[model samples]
Target chain A: MLPYGLVTIEDRVARLLTELPPNPQFPTQGATLFVDLARRQVRQAYTPRRIIETFLAGRGANMFYLYRLLDESLDPIDPSVPLIFGSGVLTGIVPSAARGNATSWSPESGVLMDSNAGDYFPSFLKMNGIDHLVIYGRADAWTVLWLGDGQVEFRDATPYLGLDNIDMRDRIATDLGGTWTRDLAMANITRAGENQVLTSAIMAGPKACYARGGPGAKMGSLKMKAIVVQGQTHDFETAQPYKQYNKEIATKLLNTSVVKNALRTMGTPFLYRPSRVLGAMGTKNNQETTWTDRLDAENITPYRPGMAGCFRCPVNCRPLNQLNDDQADRYGRGDGPEYVTLGKFGPNVGIDQVEPVIRLNNICNDLGLDTASTGSAIAWAMELYQRGIVSKSDTGGLELTWGDAELVERLLFAMSHREGFGNVLADSTRAIERGHYPTEARKYCMAVKGLMQSDPHDARILKAFALGLAVSTRGMDHLRNRVTLEINARINDDPGFKAKLYGGPVSAQPNNYETKERAVRVCENIYGVGDAVGMCRFTTKLFNSPSLPGLEEFSSQIANVTGLEFDADVLDRIGLNIMGVERLINHRLGVRRSDDTLPDRWFDEEITVGAYKTEKIDRQEFDAMLSRFYAISGLSDEGVPAEAWRQELELVLSGPA
Target chain B: MSITVRLPTTLQTSGQDSLTITEPVENIAELVRVLRRQLPGFPAQWDDSMLNFSVNDEVVLHRAEERVLASGDVVEIILALSGGTPVPRSAC
Candidate 1:
């Protein structure tokens, strides 16, 4: 059944060593916990040699390995498509590395998807000695899987089925007789996830979520209500260099970086004013690029009475909003109203008020829905209604009008329950549009590979940002390769800094396409490393701050903490290897060079109302940029991985052709 | 006769929400010079990397000197924070 010289799965397993290569001893490395609900079996296994490169690296690498191991034998919606949670190698050991990854076959994106989230869940997971937890097969009933103190328990979760994320957390606390914030941490879904809504997310804590790619839908499909981790903090012996570097990073983050000042005070809403001023704000489903000042940072600051941060993070960037009685009725209070949430819910939908936007954000979060997808989906429908493609009759006599926050809130509840018209929107924009006006609605869908566009930046003006969104592994996302530094207006003239950062003489002009491939490639590598190490990109060079921790610092930290001798170059290679695996995975799923493209709207529609009017992506220039990107990424013009890349990554093609 | 210049909280002078430029200004550079003179703690020289200017809600991406300002124009002066991209989650 296998081709000549092809390595089988069995062969790869046989070659795996039980222990890591002898290195400086550290407690970061741990066993993979495999839970099989179908057989009611739980087992612990060491990282296999085949995936050790990614396994040792963690997060993004872990996500890549999961996608690589996606069972071609099963359908995308199959419950056997294991939902895997991976802790970063440096997670819990270093500051800003307080994140974890949740990867599964996306029922929405129709591809393998990984969503990263902050909070102490990942740290708790690592504390409980789990590097990666893989849940396999569907449970016979709603169940909660509890792991802590080297014990695994499967408890009945039927009573908690219809609860929102906040209520579920409370119930879990009451049932377990432990405070969720103090001793226990959890990942839970809400009614949206329970109903297998394609846009659902998994709430990681009260404040954060793994909010993309429908990992929540996968969990719901598996009949998993929650996974709780009870952890005891373990102190690791660290070298002097590690301690010194850690202190230096904290000092720079707290006292040095000017960017952190606004972030600390206003959280992500600080970017809102700048986004509007830059003409990047996507208002009214991206038909316009500006909105009312009611959603401005200064205006929104009143509701944000406090701020919070992930474990060990210095910059407390999460805004804790004070909810009114009406807004708190269902969703309850959680941290939010971030830039994206405000952008998507406010300007993108033509609603300008800050409080109402925060209300929508709360409802979406409580329902375990991806705020990006939720807002984008509703925006698309509103646009459809504007175009007269969708009627009030189709919307169950409710007018899908712009700025109708009340109607949007009602639809969100209906979507969670899959009621009437809301059932149609529960899927992606592409699917919803296809089911209605397939031919006419296709262009207005604003989706790339079934995932709705998340970033509220109007892509017509920013060429590299547009390209990044087009080629993202998880379609239409900003987090993957967004060169956030492009927002620095001063960079426009700083060719030297651009040259040094991108490793080429790239233009810093947002609209320029020449030499942009280099910048994109560098960003991809940096983000790759950031995700792999379980560190937030905001604290890394990927964010606008140039002096933030980069590959070299990550390398030093990893060496000092784990004794793994990964130099900066090796870390970059790991990033590239992850890219290579993603390419292969997408290739297997029928993605080609043709699919690596922006929507026609981006190429055709110009920003009509700005000083930078007539700003649109040049198709020919974008194609050339794509070619350069492919060449640099070791891919053919067709976007397929080259033999050299495969050999370099030690990847052998042995599956069905 | 005057341009209403809005300032972010970080760059506000004497906790004022906005400042009025009484001096005649040709462009953002001239406006910045007036602000440096009028407002205490304002940098002596215009740092293009540190501050961003928008005339009538339109971003003057580069060469702020070229963006001609008119009387009664709303020239928003804000700290040059990072660009308009959000982090992975809605929150950081």
Candidate 2:
């Protein structure tokens, strides 16, 4: 009894039988695409009885698709396996920030990780008369997939291969023969992908990037050169129901003055000071708990003109600034030394000057290198040099001195080209730890689960964030569980209000041990939903929009979008399902609770300078928080989500959680 | 005879985007009081405990009580937390 004009299974099967090639990749069994008349296209469709049911059902569907695509091998550890990008029912149609998600086997953490970008992809796909694109297997040569209006063409882009992101973008625009507009089309990857850098990211829009887990490298490994999507319009279908929903949410979001103010003014960079002040900004290879006063003074003083932002984003946090006269002459303009870049490249490398950090950020961006990983690797090298494990002879006579801009520039170039010492540094701190200087390298490698830390938020003042990073599928990422709200609340002048929001007394602060478990759990669950839908966490986290919805609201959005009567409980189950499947993926990969831990220095050393001096996160408290987090997440004592949780998610038994 | 009182980045817009202005004051406290008269909301944004007034790059943390202001001292009232919060007025 579905809508009559909707593409039915019979119709699609008939079309496929006639039109599909002998080597088509669609799974013949265990999955079916349905044409919901209301939706007007063929898509993987399911109806769950409750929130838990939907979660389990959706995750089961995705896992089944993943396994079938991988030739029925259920090993998550297999690097050759394809990454399945899935969106929850509410994804594109939802008025809130909840939008799109990317699910892949993470090379960094060696587990299935889900990360969210912005809403552009989901909305575009929906508008294009498609639900999802299941990318399977590696390509044989450097190729670009152009999904234009009503046609998808695969072109050989070997000529543009080995180019950096900025150049690649320019080349694509020139070849495509149009002025590229930011009206929700897709393009990503560069020569960094060609190099197969594990931390390399695909840049989209001007600043929006599919940053985590080397999607670019994955594309490069497949011999896929680039993906150019065009003809996608920004306008959504304005049905009566859609109009009503958009109006209500838009009115609510615009009405909230504080939310609007915070986003429109400071953007995500506001966290820089708070994180630094609270001793959370990772510094000196995560060895330094707080940045020096001089470092802060140099970085934050410049009054730059003009603001930049992602497509359709109201908060223009990206600052286009001029550093020194030389830099202005070179790059012409610089794209932000944003919080992560500033903290990672500046204080982490022991550089106190803002201009150098700005230059370093621009170089990394232009070279298509991840600043966080790049900075951490360089910091490790510096530490090794200082400790005599690495000498001037090792560095080719270049002094790895703190606050030296010239040394930083040389090292960055060396790392990019994999030249001399840069070859060793290019492999990341984790790889370096396994190399000859294990003891010295291990002391400075500031990463959890192989991925380097992002943000300068001190783990001591922000224990929940530390715990989240420890347990994140992609190693030490801030997005998995951004505990900024809890930290901000605890640090506010109003102790009673802070206690009310975070659930504790002033002295027994949530920033301390007592409340970290619950805090992380809430953040993870909300973020998990965001990831499943592929929404940007910045819009959700900073804007304080109704992105982190409870089960009922999630269901309502899905119901509104697809015209499916999904229950509220079904939405909650979807989150549980995604987490459970990811845990199983990690388990299959041999990841255990021991893998979920912070570097030793975070526990042993106290912050020596800045506002929160002498503060250190306690190891016992961190462990206790992990235990509680696992229990609440329906995971085992070993930090694996339980079988019952898996069953609740309705995923087929592939392996242990 | 008066000394020039320098404004912080946040309040620079109100003083016609000028960094320094001639103000009739004998001490730092008097200068602050004069600044408050000129700018109504200046004192509320500052914390006295953390406030460190400077004169030509020198810390005058305790100089409000002991040191008398000279005609051309180049007094600067620097807020420790200027960059931390979003300033309402434009730095333009």
* lDDT (10s digit) by residue, model 1, range A100-162: 888876788886577888887887887787777877778899998988898999988899989
lDDT of 1 at A413: 90
For each model in turn, which proportion of the native inter-chain contacts is also found? 0.37, 0.00
Docking class of 2: incorrect
Give the lowest summed-lDDT range of ten residues in model 1 chain A.
A9-18
- Tens-digit lDDT string for candidate 2 (A1-657): 211232333442333234222331211111123222222233343222232233422233344344223322333323345554444444445554424444566544445544444425544544454434545445556667666574556678788876776677677777776544443355466556566665566665444455665555655555666656666454544222555655655554444332343334434444454445545567667666556544443244463556665434344556666665664365435666667788878788888766677777777776666777778778877877878888888778878886677888887777666677776766674465447355656766777777777655657655666787788766777777655544322123334533543345332343466666665665566556555543445544221322223444545554554455557445445555656666665666667999888877878888775444666778787888788778877899877767766564433332122
TM-score of chain B of 1: 0.76
CA shift of A410, model 2, Å: 3.1
List RMSD in Å for every model shown: 4.6, 9.3
- Number of colliding residue pairs in model 2: 25
Over 4 Å off, model 1: A1-26, A48-56, A237-241, A256-259, A325-332, A430-437, A650-657, B1-4, B22-50, B65-73, B81-92
Q: What interface RMSD, in Å and to 1 decimal, does model 2 have?
A: 11.5
Identify the leading candidate in terms of lDDT: 1
How would you encode candidate 1's per-residue C-alpha lDDT over B2-88 as one tens digit per residue?
Answer: 899887777665879788887898876676667767876555213324456788877776555557888999987765555322212
Q: Positional deviation of A627 in candidate 2, in angstroms?
A: 1.4
Interface RMSD of each: 7.5, 11.5
